[model samples]
Target chain A: MRNPRTGWLLLSPTLIILLIFGFAPFLYVLFVGFNQWNVFSADDGLVFNGLDNFRRLVFDDDFLHSVGLTARFAIFAIGSEIILGFVLAQMLTRNFPGKSLFRIIHTLPLMVAPIAVGAIWRLLVIPGFGPVPFFLDRWFDLKYQIGSYPDQALWTSVIMDVWHWTPFVTLTMLAGLSAIPKEPVEQAKVDGASRFQVFWYVTLPFLRPVLLTTVFIRIMDAIRTVDEVWMLAGGGPGTRFTGIYIWRVVFPRTDYGYGSSISLITLYLTIVLCWLLFIAISGRRKGEVE
Target chain B: MKKRFTFILVIAIALLANMSLVSADMHGWWAEAAAPYAGATIRGVSESTPPSNYVADVLAAQFTELTGINVEFETTSWDQMYSKAINDMEANTGIYDFVYIEQDIIYSYLAQDYLVNLTQFAADNPDLAYEGYDESAFTSFADYFKNADGDLFGVPMEAFVKVYLYRKDLFEDADIMAAFEEEYGYPLAPAENFDQYRDNAMFFTAYGENMDMDLWGTTVQGSTGHPASTYEFLESIGPSFGLYNWGINLDAGSAMSANGGALDGDTAVEALTFWLSMLPFAPPEATSSTWDEVASSFAAGRAAQGWVYGENAAWIATDESRSAVTGNVGVRLPVTAPGVIEAAEMGDGYIGYYDGGAFGVPHSSRNKEATLLWLQFIGQSSVQAEWAAAGARITHTATFDDPLIAEQDAKVDGYYTLLEEQGPLFAGAPPFPFHAQVREVIDPFIQRAILGELSPADALSQAAAAVDEELSRLGYGM
Candidate 1:
């Protein structure tokens, strides 16, 4: 904090790593978007094809469908996660018996890797071997088949996401809730302010920034989710999100130029979405202050 | 007496020296040829299938011990194996010395010149060639990996057909057979035609329901999300209905009947419809099942019959630890439409897919010579019998006669016998350099059809048109 030179030198390693691994690939991908490069057909090399890839993306129904599907998925998954997370966070803020144990148990799903979560859910839902189907059939007399039914597959993915990331949202919200000042709440209670009125006026405003940040992070993560969904469904009928679709194009099809163009478009869409979300939330907060 | 003893000792010494020379001729070639690359480590990547696992765990270790050249083989999921290998080769990274070239994808690899010409490599390095490893020893399956000029690109590691598997116990049951005969008005047996197959599926499904048994009539590899579903419909189901070469006429470069392709023909629609009809008789998991899961479903006794990849037949039939229906499993050729078998016999069409893969040295490989030796090591006749037993695959004709394979054949209900006798009826994927590109475009339509988002007839019509557009984009049939 004292000397600029020392600070610069200390930060150089991290900067170099970010430059080499992060920025370089991003730049390369951007460059690749303007060319016609089939990774398998290397003999042709990277031929500059101008806006052809972009033009192709416009007409590419699969890419468009994937983008729309990803948007819908992010909305459902992040919305559920945020609401559940906030409620859990509020409950955890209170003094309760075995609070530490409860917190640990509630947060366990957050520790599971995305790929492992997909594998676990896949095992749980697969008809014969999975217990979920067995229990559903036994208890409700309903035949639960995620593999055959697209609706079931899509909702199962949503549920899996909620199960996996709600804990992370809860943890973040819990931290924010703990940091909220207690003096105002106590004053409101002495003045005979109702619990709901006091909480809405005081706690909500305090947690606004934390809520926005959590929503932003979860939105980005949910949009880019591939591993869990792919493992569970292989981007099958209902769960072919943008991440899996892009992977299919780039890896299986090996159409680097088209894949790159689609990726760049997705990136722009994600940025715009986050920006709109930020503006709306921040504008609301500013209006309240006014 | 002393002179005679000395003469006899001298003769004995000469005979011992000659025997040592013969011994050196038989086995010393590997070490002597591999001397230059002793400390060099050659890396390979393959799908984590049984054959590839054997190569990774058993053959690699044995090869290292014999030649002193370290073998580092990485076996991963099917998708990762391909992406990793392709990325390395395309980037010219020299990361993998060899990669698995599946029979279906060899055309693409060859078209890109991504693989080293193994036949030429051996000719160029005569001393490095293993005497026992002759290309001629391989079965007809090896021909799939050859180029137009008759040069081999890959060494065949595994080869098998997709065969129809049935539950022998159910088929042989006195009550079940009587019930089946009464309903279908025919002797209850393995299906010999499409109608019989359908009837069997319906009967068994109802029979299970009536008897309060947990069973389905068939396993449908109809996953709406994965390529396995496309493979099932196109390779297994379509071909059984007499639609060959994915119903695409490569010569005309079209998938539409209007353009001379059979993709949207009545036969293809009939095939798709029949396959969809079986979905009700298949277990709930059938819609989500890949080839792996189909094998599992059969092994778990969830399906009475199914079209299963032969590579899984051995384990599902004999490995009691994994298979509940081990002893009750039976193998036979898939039921074909009328005239389909004749066409296959005449070598004009195929009944089903003959699926397999070979390990080939990449052009980008830094250790081609060393990798070549490793390939030859696995391709040797002496290794075929055990490899065949382990993987349920046979690349060499001689493997069928091997005592180990013969023993395995009986255990798997003479699967090897059927393979040897009927393999000619099955064919590898058509030699299309645009295989993946075409498959990608057509896959979604098949998926849509399976999920009932599109009718089978409509799906094929749209898919055929899409394939035409794609093929045209790729500059085919211009």
Candidate 2:
């Protein structure tokens, strides 16, 4: 291990960053959750309301609804990204004409900044005037206007996120695919394993670690995303999602104390959930060797 | 492990070093910013998220030229600015020398003494005093800027009113006019009534459908954030219930004006409901659109009508933009209720007014003298005239009154005429504490009604409950 002391020292920066950004802010938020002070108010003037804000968040119907909505959005968005990304990676792995160009074209989305992507999608999908409206009209011959339904805004947000982030999943999976040895697959085939069996058993097992890692990273990014939601719906046609809800409270209202509390709560939830997923996935594969 | 450790270490060191550079580059003076104010890197912030803030290069350069004070004007979207401002201010880090305090935010800032009171500063500086600034010139627009006790805490930063704009050639054309008048039982002479305005707007928009042109009758910014263009529909319906009216005195003395003239429950409710009913006619994605979105939509000729603001009048109406109908854009008066007073009974009135107050020195200013000098330079007729001609609309009559400014182009004249003619219907900022929170409820509810999520009555009722809650929280009248 090259001396535990030196090894620890070498890894100290990451540990320190994790402690400060990861843990400290999480702890501060719990402390802040009890107070009624906002950012505009004096920090000393923070009133210890003894979970009054949390009581509001936990008990309020809208707060609980958004929690449900967030869980639903995360599940759908992350799951879609993974499946679509894997499919895209699989397709690109095969030899084909214009394979390089296809790979580059798919990654173009990942290259664009999240905000720029959000802005472009907003322009394209605008209910009446945008290309999305045109595309819908041409495809279905029936108008799919964003005006009639409020909840459609939430769905549109999901589609935009899928478009901008699936490529990230593809890249991660492609890297995993490259790390697998061709000999293992050939041996499986020689043993009379079907092509589907070779992929389902041999190829898939090797890619398990990568899949788990990608899902973990993707879940974190998807939860924190707000740009597309902000640009597209403004948390409307009704305030339902956590990301937009946080932004709306902070800016025009300047409710820092409450806003910070919500942010901290989200961060804590994310960390705990991520930890649980890691342990669960790692537990399932404990007996297996690399 | 060594390679992994080194790789992580390199990224960490670079990130920390970069953060330090950003920190060093940032004006941390906001923490202890109470210096003599000169020879200091003063951090100033504003959330002018529109056609104006894009011209920050001009504002920063002019500010430096006028005061010899080099300002580090940090621009962020509204949320970040609010978050950073509040965080920095609470920390007492002299981070910001100047901050944009909307009229509504004054109450909280004043309650906590986060902002300095401006009464004493204006008194101390004779040249920058309110006397020379023409109080009568601002009378019709002054109520919204004052606190409950009549103290002016924050002056207007920037403001522009909404005007009903339509296609002139289309409105004058015989086919469209005949159908509108035929169906609505009224001649559409610039839409003196809401019935006429919507009916006329719809007529021109529907005519395009009939003409097989890719056009709609009218479009207004339907965004949840400030739906100023939607006010045309609101005011159109407002007059039906006495929800729209302001004092129009020939003399500026005793000169009274309503706070959007919304003082009572019925008027407030009526205004709220009447305002929302017009949203359905707007573009489908109006909920996300802000001022710029609305301007582009109108200019593209895809939309035949929009409630135009002076801020974009110069740009949207110009030929360089390839707007659907640039020169053909005709400015019309804001329409009122059906029977109160038609164009037949009374001529023109201020339909929807937004107060944009300029800078005044605060009692807590580190250098009140220097701040007032900056204020005077901004208020100076010559400078104001130049800014007006350049497209940053000031509230002062003199800026638009100047021949230099008014003659710059038809937009300048249009801006001048709108200010002069619409002075009667002016509504200053709603003098409320937590200006933002109050808006959070009102703006959303108004949009809900327009998008048909809530009926006009339901939206108003929900909004009333929300506003009442905010008012109670802010220690307003119980």
Candidate 3:
């Protein structure tokens, strides 16, 4: 019924690019997931092993441990990022002097590359040589090496993630806060609602969609955390995050088949988790409407 | 007038002819062989070590001048180099004409047929070999790059032995020695055995504490989450305790004791325990220290001793700007448990780790002939002395007697002499095609042990079991 030729012409470039870069690679991954492929094996030419690789995943303790670490990292990092971002957004939304400058300065961390962030933090936290250790000793007398000790390495990485990404969440929330209807706040005040009550009922409900979106984006991004952790802690001291674990399997180990399976598993889980979150949020909104 | 004019003209003609012949002689056989491939661009990738940097900066320019083939040699990190090279080879992409193959990965490269056999290539194309390329001049380290049939695959570029280095200033201090003797009932000196090593570590650590100095007894390559920590445990500490070949029982081809493998055997567990014991004596950064950090720590005078790579020895010993303890560093064979040498000699173990890398033409190379000429050009004996001096890694037997190396031996406190005399006691990693797989399974366990999440015995036991399971899955144990 529509002009199909013009529509196809308009979408061809993007579709082709996506097919070449994104879809093709995903299809290849799916294909390889069912085959036994080793990059270094001369004898085997992508031998089809069906579900063997997937079965192997069931008993892979290292992989399971990495999943646990990744989950913990996500909960702590994303949770902190959201709370700090909301607070900063609330503060910045008020009319104030040099508000633009403060906003710009807060976004500076977002401009730097994640790997550079990791490297800078590495320098800051090095024992005996770094300024951080010197000040900590002078003030707190705590002799903690942030990226070395098993107990501290993962948390240090989490703090770094928060520092890098909290600005993004703040920016998103700020946009949402600006678009909020002003009448609700006046009505709340006229009804003698306390500041906390107004915020809980009016501000939070209006910001729910934005908060859900930010959380989803962050959770997905957090699952793909590699560059900073690789540069700083190297997924070490028993903090082997899942992303680096898959990378080690694929590249270092050259077990392409198994790596592809793990990749698919990660992709499947991400999709399912995101879908569940979306459905739950939708259901809550429906209940509120009712 | 006619006779004088004729004589002057003939002399001028003769001089010009002689200059042309001299230029041709200097160009050498490689120039003639590469004449057809002139102006062709070839690419390579290698780790950004001093030696590789020298090759990229100095040798590539020289080779381009001599052979007329332009070489764009990328000096990159170890991870990127391996990834790019392997990807190119796997995909049959003619991106890299040549690749650096470390001793540890040569087995995987050969097993995969990713590399062209240099011996066969030479035999097939005698015209491509450089005039000065004598294979016999290469040291035994080159054997690591050869196949079971005694055919060469990669051209050895840099070879060195991992060695023990101590701060002479701390060992000879009278007060420290007296304290050590009173406490441990032995004179404080460069360690002779594991026991002495441990005692010295404990004493120096305590001594530093008493002096209120920010010092540690030793530096550990114990980045608990990196492959470097695993390498330190497997190569440096494991060999000294008589756990050879990564404690893998090759007789049964499994790492599990149930399959007769010794990966978690008594000797390996003991070695792992001893290695972890040094963690407390090591600087606080031990769990984050890689080879580079370890070298930096030793050079900064944060540690009394370290198992330093030979590549860093010359710079650490002579570069005053980098090394705070310049001229006070002493190099020796690592202190080993008793019977390690004998066990190595009797063909059951090794004393230390021999580490190096070589350049090989890949099968995917579009310009194999030109790349071959380039490899042979660097492998020439004439260039060995300069490269060895700059990189502090020698791969030729004749280089041991080179005047430049002799000069550096004195500068590095006889590091060259020790390597020349005791290099044979060391061995490269076993020829396992699944090297990265096995190491990945074990590396985390080592980090776990370092973090005290698992005891040494438990870590090794779990690691051995995991390795066995992996091996069986990969069709080894079956």
Candidate 4:
């Protein structure tokens, strides 16, 4: 659309900003990952320790446990979100009374900040004062205490994530659903095909790309979740996901070297995961073309 | 007789006039010293505790008004405050003129040379030294902020012990007393030993259950994932069982008894087990409670007894709007195991944590001269009484005798009296430069124990091993 030099000049500012804020820190963290640097002990500057931090990470039990916890969280949270989001999106595709109001109400949770969401859920589940516990105790004689029960605390965080993020999935899927052509469904109906058959053969194939994209995004986000969980349970008991584990190390412990090493490992693992999903999506598209 | 009365009156009048002149001279000194930096805006950061809030809202404004200097004090959560201050100092960003240094972390700061020696600073700049400011006016707690050479690095702002608080009304109730005595074969009183404390906890818990009340026996600061839980075990509960200095032998660089430390010794295991045993008697919220929540739980009348920080004692005993057991709150020293109190008296150990903080001028500060004035202003005897009343923390020895504190002493069931007389028994955290690092490694094990993921014996054993490994890695005792 323009001369090459003009385009390069116009993009220089954004490229420079990206280099300064994004690429520079990434390179610094990578460098730090190979060194022994405790902020309190950093007056002597970074001590080059080669792969020592990475070597230690291999045997770090707490970090390993946090990785497992994050994996579990991602699977449960993203799984429930996708299924629930698809169902909601399907329902919204149909004409209904107060549909606009329902959409607005449903999307409100997505608008709340992650930190606020965590605070809100914490208030909802706090013992004695929280209505969730009060009602559970009154109706079912159940003692719903997140502070004591690790399993309950973990599940509560999953539920909180679901509540906060399902709206995004629903809206994205709804857009995909709306953009689907009507002719195939009409032809399927004309052919005396059942609703399940039409959905499987016509509607689902068209929605596959959107579903893949949504799941990919959710997986990336859920794996890195810290704020809401930190706010809700404060990385307490069952809620010390990988992100919170890294935060505890870097900030509270001030173990910059180990924290950097763990962060890089997590980043690499995340990239590998997205690559696999990307391969799956690309492969599926090629198969469809055939 | 008239001549004698006239002579006495003349003497009194002259003394009063001299006092006013001295006060005026002090204010004049502040103005003259601050004249160089009159228009400069000095920034500081502290945790949003009552004392720090007083410094921000009241003292800052007063200092500014007196000297025409602008002060911007940011009071935030404890974690944020520490992270911000440490980051600024480490980076030499000069973002903060002064920072609150908790008694526990002052050693770390001193080791890093992150703070200005206020004593030396004042001595070098004699013109800026306030005549009214005296370091001796502070309680012995001020000694915690001194470096190896006995040079002052921080001005003590707040100091209080973790005291045992119980429900006076319930203890005094005839029926409750009879029931407790019938069950325990002793008169119900503030516990004097570990066994008595446990018996009281059990009896009170059962009594509350039987009476269909919302009371528990005690509050436990046992949040499984927070540092508060570690502090409860190490600083508060462990010392009561005669395990001191976090059971770590700093000289030997070990936490294992075999290596000359008592971290995993029998007493530490017993301490942890005894503390965990109270969980059944603690309210459902105990597992989630930190120091703040423990205070709130006691104030709400949900716990009949608890080891509460003294900073909360005044409010829990007097603030009816926030406290349900205001008039019935009682304060005492925590029950210690046999020989523990003796050890504390001999200075071989401590009974519990003496928690407080002080303001220090960071070495990275751009306005050290101006900040010194603010620190001294708060350190003065005239400001101590009101600040102590507002914050339930007394750093100045004279504050306990002030009329305001005397009135507060009655309302808080002589909490100030206990602090003044018994504060020496409750020591601050050990002077470990690796305090945060060691705590982080050991905290998970303690959390595991709290959640029943590990037995008390196993938790302490593993924690001891972890601490030893960490200390060795840090080249301690090498």
Candidate 5:
């Protein structure tokens, strides 16, 4: 009876915050999703078109194209962040001359703000005159660089995203890495196990839960990112992705119900991907426990 | 556990504090606070035109000096201005006292009953209406503003016609211009007809070697992924072809369909084909040029002539500014089509232009009283004359017709002559009730044709088919 009272007392603040900012909007989104309402006419009540919005998306070529682009972009961008993030986190775990400074530097991108990262990269990649392009051309004679073509622009946007966010993954992985018990590692070392063998067998298995969790979180975030891509390319060199595709629907042309349908599809995609990752994590953890 | 609860409590308080800080003052327009002397405070909005800045900052200062009323100006881009006006008016947001709208928005805005009828305002103040303002103050084409019942919603500011500009020095060369004039049987002024313009541009571009000039004859805006550039090209060529005549005339609609052609697959194909065929004569990379690029090309001395809006004049007058051929350029009317049938032989023989911006009110403004004051002040003969005199504003007839403005402003003479003689060439029409839908159908066709993704004929036909589908969905009678 005392624990129940304490639980209620402890959870009230969080529940209230989530209720107002999170649940309220989430509930309103249902009404918005069902109607032909727009930012201009949000007040003029719902048109009650039922599943008509979703029905249109089935035949919409732009929707299909955006879905494909998001999958491809997320796979490549998230893959890079995780691999690089894991390596950096591992390096930080070891003692080095400037380990403290390196740890501080790792957190710098996270602290600088996402908009600033986008602005900095946008200037460097501006096609003809930007110094980055100038220097690349001077060295390699690769005149047409990443800023001009749609696919190249997508990759450049991804690289800038990775630059800003890989650090967050590194910080999480560092905590996960440090949390591992020392006894198993000590035993492996005494038993003459090599560093690579010991890491693969002992350390990797132990940290699999945290790494999977971090990767799952990053995947969800990568799908929703609009601002960085918005600032970097303005979704151009012509839009080849979901974030920009959704923006075009919401703004420029105020096709509200259709845009809401696209957002709903994005939410579903996020849940399905993260759920799959969770299953894999559970299976791996269960194997280790056995 | 106690410490964690304390931390969470502090975070909740902090979040609430932050939210309060970021919230905007959402009280609908405060008429009393906005206006101290007048019965209501007037809040006006205009697009970020250079003249609007002058009016808001410099001229507003003068207006305030003359009449002590606190007025505030809200400004944004032309696109933003129209979208906001359409939204604010439709929703009755009451955030603005006066809104500067464009012709496109005016069509839709008038369809609704938000605008305060100008009849009462004009009747109450006769000197403010036609009595003080003369025909000279306005372009000849001011009749469009009259509603079906012969009522005015907004006042005309200026007659905007497409002024075909070229490098005078480049045209002055005898050897090059002699051949052009002899072939065309007129001065090598800008093309007066669409066919003549195309042929003349082709000749100039091909003989670039003989002319000893590495210049193309014409450039057009293609870069921006919208229908505005297409609309410019369409308006310039449509009258020549007789596609439309001042809105869809039900009596003449059949003739328009047969003679000029319908907005069907074939017509769409023909439209795209014509514009794409002229692509080579544009800048090498004109595939990426918008209206800004066209002006920049002219300013950089890269092209002989091009299509651009009138605001470029402000850019040109600043000699140390971005324009390369600042003082050397002159303006004229766009070219029309070649004579085909005996009757078609006459062609339209005129150019085309669309309106920049106009004003409208929303149904839901909290500050309707204050907004009415600004609307009246903006429509006043004295304010119009003053704005025109500054050389920065296009005049509504009430303002431009004032003899005081004509005497005061030098830039008004050249522009006035253009408006008087050629302003009737350009007229305003609604694109479609559902304009967003129209762009959805129109943009891909233009984009594809310019990118060489499809032949002009194929691209246009498909685009027309798409637009028709959208129109059918909207239940349009036409």
Candidate 6:
């Protein structure tokens, strides 16, 4: 007594919505990517430029540099966030006075907007005047213009990203830790295993999926990071991330065709990275479903 | 009979007086013409500057009261304003009725036909033109937004020159002067050349160090991460060194002198090199500073001299709460190298950047007539005086002589006198349809030079090559 018409009707709304919201724009962008389409001077229909737009990307030094910078930023920011987030999550899991207060305090940074965090850090790290430079100079004898020097500016952005996003990873890790069964860990402890050994042998294996998921999410986010870096150094001091670079190409240059082509490249790169991570995660446990 | 005649005379006089008051009414005419478009709400976007904020918060409401046409003016940062306005127009969304057309970008807008021809629109609907609206009242600044054929494209809203602001207190100090003269073998005064400027910067910086105070010789807008850094170099610093029209040679249509342009010529290289050399003498904040921060540094007495935008000229001199050196600030035309002024006067170059923007009706706007009325309302000569004083920007020729501005001239150490006398020396950005594209190609290289990633000569050479390549790709110099 199944009505095929009814089934089709039920799915039609979502199908239409997706076509309009997601598929249409994607297809239009694909069409634009193959042409010399300047939106401002778009009088005659898009001129067919074949792969010329994509070819331009190969020779664009700024674009290539941005892609490289984004990778470096991603590796530094996410790698640090994962390790630090896990440690903080573990510290919070232990029984202690004011544990809830500490948990709340630790998550405070996540509530703030990324751009605001960047601005606050910009103020803090300003040399000769900012509190950060003052304290670091007095306490550690470290004196440098943090946001003005090319090397230091990149590292400063990484630090701000970690400060703003580490809380998300920690909260996710804490949830996973709470859900893990205590039996294996307790048994290991009773068998005279040290704290580190018990955690490594019993707790870590169980937490593998959660760790992979959090890292994957963080990596994806780090690849597309823009706001904080924009507010802080504005992709300057030689720290032009992929996001800011693409923004400049599209808005300032107004070369929608070439910008779309570049954007498609980034999209494909992210997809490939995510696919590899997925495969690695699945292979870690032979029978586990991701 | 005599009492009856007197009563009639009194009534007649009262009626006539009321009639005369109505005749002189400014908004009464607007109210009559706007009857058809009353209650129509027009949205506009502009950078969040003093004049824009004033128009949004004060003038827009008054306009509504007079014309019954509501204006929803959204003031935002330059990037966001450009993005929103351009996107809306590109998409033909009719989301915005008016947009800010900066003098630099008008050429691009004109090329794209994104704006409605103001002159044509005015002619098409003569009924919509307000009584106070007179296109002739505007100064030559309006020419920046007009086509070669003399068709008006936008209504000039704000105009100002970027001038050099110095700490008069520091320059006048007897001890500092004697020390400077003893070291440099010249009287310590406002610099007239690059050499003098450099000596002053070095001398004051050393003086500050000796005194053990948190002060610097100059404020350099050297934020390598933002467009402000690039703008400062190209507009303020480069012009003084004789790099006019962005060093592009009109005859050869190239940026490289070998190809017959001056973009990478000796003067341009020296200009950028000198600009970067100020890093050591500037406040540490210079590396992350924009025009606003530079003004703040000068106003707070942290720096002895800096290039400050005219929009900030008034507040830095008049507003005590915000400006620490309110009473001791001096303003003058930026010092230039030898032959620079004469060359500029002879139409070979420009001395400084004449920065400003205008309001134009977007073609995608649903209520073009309503938007046109709003532009006219603001463009009226009577409104120019108050807006000029508030924003430190003047578009009308008569605004230079406004009593309020004249009064403010005395407060800011004759900043207005310099503006009135030397204003003709500066000019707006060259009318290039590829302005944004060329700037984008040049900005990063300039930023790299400031960050010490490239030598001045290498940066300029590379930038010139990139710009040449881009121009070719866009069919400019092919």
Q: Who wins the DockQ comparison?
A: 3
Ranking by DockQ: 3, 1, 6, 4, 2, 5
Best candidate according to TM-score: 4
For each prediction in turn, the share of the native Cα contacts (below 8 Å between chains A and B) that it retains comes to: 0.49, 0.34, 0.51, 0.46, 0.04, 0.55
- Misplaced by over 4 Å in model 6 are A1-15, A40-45, A127-129, A137-141, A287-290, B1-24
What tens-digit string does per-residue lDDT give for candidate 5 at B84-149?
Answer: 665566557776766775555555456555676665555564433433334334433444544677
State model 4's lDDT: 0.90
Off by over 4 Å in 3: A40-43, B1-24, B28-32, B346-348
> Candidate 3 lDDT, tens digit per residue, B133-183?
888889989999888988888999988888999999888888778988888
lDDT of 3 at B227: 86
Clashing pairs in 1: A236-B225
lDDT at position B405, candidate 6: 82
Query: What digit string (tens of lDDT, one per residue) describes model 1 on residues B1-478?
Result: 9999999999999999998996677567888999999989999999888788889889999889889999999998878888998899888999999999999889888878899999999999999988889999999899999888888999999999999999999999999999888887889999999888989899899988898888999989988778888999999999999998998998898999999998999999999999998999998888788898999999999999999999999889988898999888999999999999999999889999999999999999999999999999999998889888988999999999999998999999999999999999999998888888889889999989988899999999999999998787665643
What DockQ results for candidate 3?
0.57
- Give candidate 2's chain B TM-score: 0.71
Candidate 6 chain B: 10-residue stretch with minimal lDDT? B469-478
**Clash numbers, per candidate:** 1, 25, 1, 0, 17, 0
Off by over 4 Å in 1: A1-3, A39-44, B1-27
Model 5 is docked with a DockQ of 0.08
What lDDT would candidate 6 get against the real structure?
0.85
Q: Which scores better on TM-score, 5 or 6?
A: 6
Off by over 4 Å in 4: A41-44, B1-26
**Per-residue lDDT of B69 in model 5:** 58
TM-score for the first chain in candidate 6 comes to 0.87
CAPRI quality of model 4: medium
TM-score of each: 0.95, 0.79, 0.93, 0.96, 0.75, 0.93
Q: Is the docking of candidate 5 incorrect, acceptable, medium or high quality?
A: incorrect
How displaced is residue B363 in candidate 3, in Å? 0.7
